[model samples]
Structures are given as structure tokens and as C-alpha cells.
Target: MNTLAFDTCFGACSVAVTWATPEGPRGAFRFERLERGHAERLMPLIADAMSEAPFDFSALQRLVVTTGPGTFTGQRVGIAAARALSLATGAPVASLPSLAVMAHTAAHQLKGETAGKTLAAAVDARRGEIYVQFFSGPDLAALDEPLLTTPEDAARRLAGRDVVAVGSGSQLLADGARAKGLSISVRLATLEPDVRFVPEAAIPTDFGVPRPLYLRPPDAKPQDGASLARVS
Candidate 1:
């Protein structure tokens, strides 16, 4: 099966095309770091990937995307594009969470060093908040639910545990965690929680319901009459 996968849930945007073969999975093309203009760049990148690989759209077996707890706009753009492409080409679509991608990358790169310990994947959320998730072993079992919280709060929650922290939130969480007497070791990894490191195994067989994993309520919403009257 030939599959196209992408992620735009972090600071960088990435896309990859892979073909399944008897030898193993082979990547035809992989691109990353397009960043905030993912909506604009996504289609072109997909076209470029397909062009380089010379695969027929109708022959594509799956379209995979990173559904997120990252940037709201990026997640929408990526999933929308994936859905559209899937519909147009009549290919099945699958979605995986962004933190799962980070976990996969960390586990793959740090295979021998960690000796099968738990890893905390953290991504920077604006306003001093972070998106955090925990994984155990190479299979990436979830130890804690993903949350959006301040560094101190997160540190407190993860206190008294020996964990390897990876992501943008690692530095802040590590410092706070240590100050709070947590025995966690922070591992600074190059893999951002972005779509760039999405693994082939991360893709699901079924594209479940599309829902944004917002840890906190959105800032923008209809104002109450009291505030409106005060302003008026």
C-alpha cells in the first residue's frame, strides 16, 4: 500500500510519502519546516511529493494526518486537507495525535540509551502553558493523560517520578520539577512535537471521529451581556 502522511501540529509543517514493499516500508519523499503557512504550502507539498514518487492518486491506499493538541489552526488545516484528499481520491484516511508522533520519534532515536524507561513528551503551549503526555516503553504506552497546564503545575503533577522529558516544554518542566524534588531527567531531543517525525505505525486503520483535543477552553467566544453593556 502507498500512503501519504503529514503533520502541522507544531512549529514546523511536514509531509511524507511511503510505499509498502516486501523488503519493508520505503519513503519516497519527506519534507518539513514549512511552519505557519501550512495551509498555503500543504497542497503544493503534497503535489510535489506525489510528483517525485510518480504514484496515482487513485492507487493511494491511505491518507494519514496528525490530529492535535498543538496549534488550533494548524490542526484544522492539516485534517481538512487530509479529509479532502481522501474524499477526492477515494482513499481511506487515518489520524494520529501529535504527541504520539513525538513519542515515536523519541523512542526510535533513543532506543538503547534509556533502558526502557518512561518518557514525557512536552510541547510548548503559548501563555506559559504546555501540552504534555507520558509514554512507557518503546510501544509508547500512555502513563498520564495529555494536559495543558503551566510548567509548575505539570512539574507538581509529575513529581516523585523518574522520567525522561522530551520536547519544547522539557527545559521549563525539568527546572520546575527538580526544584520541586522530582527525580526526572530531561532529554533534549531534536524531534519537535510537529508532524515531521510521524511514523508509519502511527497511522490508524480507521479515521475515527475528528475532534480537537483542546485541554483548555478557547479564548474567543460570545461575550456576556454584562460585559457588552459595560463597553457600550
Candidate 2:
């Protein structure tokens, strides 16, 4: 089976195409970090990665996308692109949580015994809060519900626990944890979700319409004063 995965839910834009070969399953992936402009760059980047794999969209069996707990605009960009491609190609779509993708990446990177360590994935929410989640070891099982809170509150919740923080918000979370006298076994602050690892979070049987996983409501709201009354 051939699968394509892409993520634009945070600071990075990534794409990957995985296909089965006689030898084994193999993939081609492209990832780049940017402060903005995912809308402009994502398509070209995906094209590049697909070209490397030489995989055609018509042959895609599955399409996986990160339905974010990240930036609102970035999340929309990814889902819109995926949905459009799905409509054109007739491939089934799968949703992968962005935080879970990060956790999976962290767990996959761990070496040797990782029995008691928690994998904490976080993304900066841009108003001094973070989008966060926790998972247990390489299995990446959920340890808590997805959360949006101040870095300090998040740290307090994880106090006395051993963790490995990974994501854009890792440094801040690690700092908060240290203030609470918590132990962080490792910190991977520079890491961004790679689409190549997204398959780990894909739910084939639970497939449904993909949507942005915004834990908090949008910051911008329509101004009531400027709104005209609806014509009845």
C-alpha cells in the first residue's frame, strides 16, 4: 500500500510519501522550519518529496494529515490541502494528532531501556500558553488529555515526574519544570513534527472528516459593534 503524509501545523512544513517495494516499505520525506508562509511553501515542498519517491497521487492508497493542536492558520492550510487532494484522487483520509506525532518522534528516538520516562510534546500557543500532551514511553500511549495552559501550570502538573520534553515549547516547559524541582531527563526543543513519523498515529478504522484540533477558541472574533442585524 502507498501512503502520503504531510504536516503544517506549527513552525515546520513536512511531507512524506511511503510505498511498498519488493524489499520493504520505503518513503521519501522533506521537512523545513519556517516562522510563516506555510501556505506558499507547502505545495511545492510536497511536490518535491513526491517527486523523490516518484509516487503519483492517483496511486495513493491513503492520505494522512496532522489535524493540529498548533497554529490555527497552519492547521487549516494542511487540512485544506489534504482534503482537496483526497477529493481529486479518491484516497481515504486519516487524521493524526499533532502532539501525538511529536510524542511518537520522541519515543522513536529513545534508545535502550525507557521504562519510566514520560514523553511530553508541546507547541507554543502564542499567548504565553502551550498546546501539550503526554505519552508513556515508546508505546506512545496517552497519559493525559490534550491541554492548553500556561507553561508554569503545565509544569506543576508534571511535577515529580520524569520526562523528556520535545517540541518548539520544550525549552520553556523544561524551565518551568526545573522551577518546580522536577526532573527532565532530556530536552529536544528544536524538534518539529516530521510527516515521516505521522503514520504511527494514523487510525485506519476510525477514519472521519479531518478538522483542525484547536483546543482553544480562535483569538479573533467578529466585532459586534460593526455587525449589521440579520435580515429576517
Q: Considering every candidate listed, which one attains the maximal lDDT?
A: 2
**Number of clashing pairs, model 1?**
0
Model 2 TM: 0.89
Off by over 4 Å in 1: 194-199, 222-232
lDDT of 1 by residue, 1-232 (tens): 7888888788767778878678887775555664579798878888877886647788888888887887878888988888788778888778777888888777767776555676888887878888888877656777777888887788887755667888888887787787777767777645665344555555677765456666667778767664554564
Each model's lDDT comes to 0.75, 0.81
Per-prediction TM-score: 0.85, 0.89
Q: Return the clash pairs for model 2, or none.
A: none
Query: Candidate 1 overall Cα lDDT vs. reference?
Result: 0.75
Estimate, for each residue in 184-206, the C-alpha lDDT of model 2 and write its tens digit.
65566777888676544344446
On TM-score, the candidate that comes out on top is 2
Model 2 misplaced regions, further than 4 Å: 110-115, 199-204, 228-232
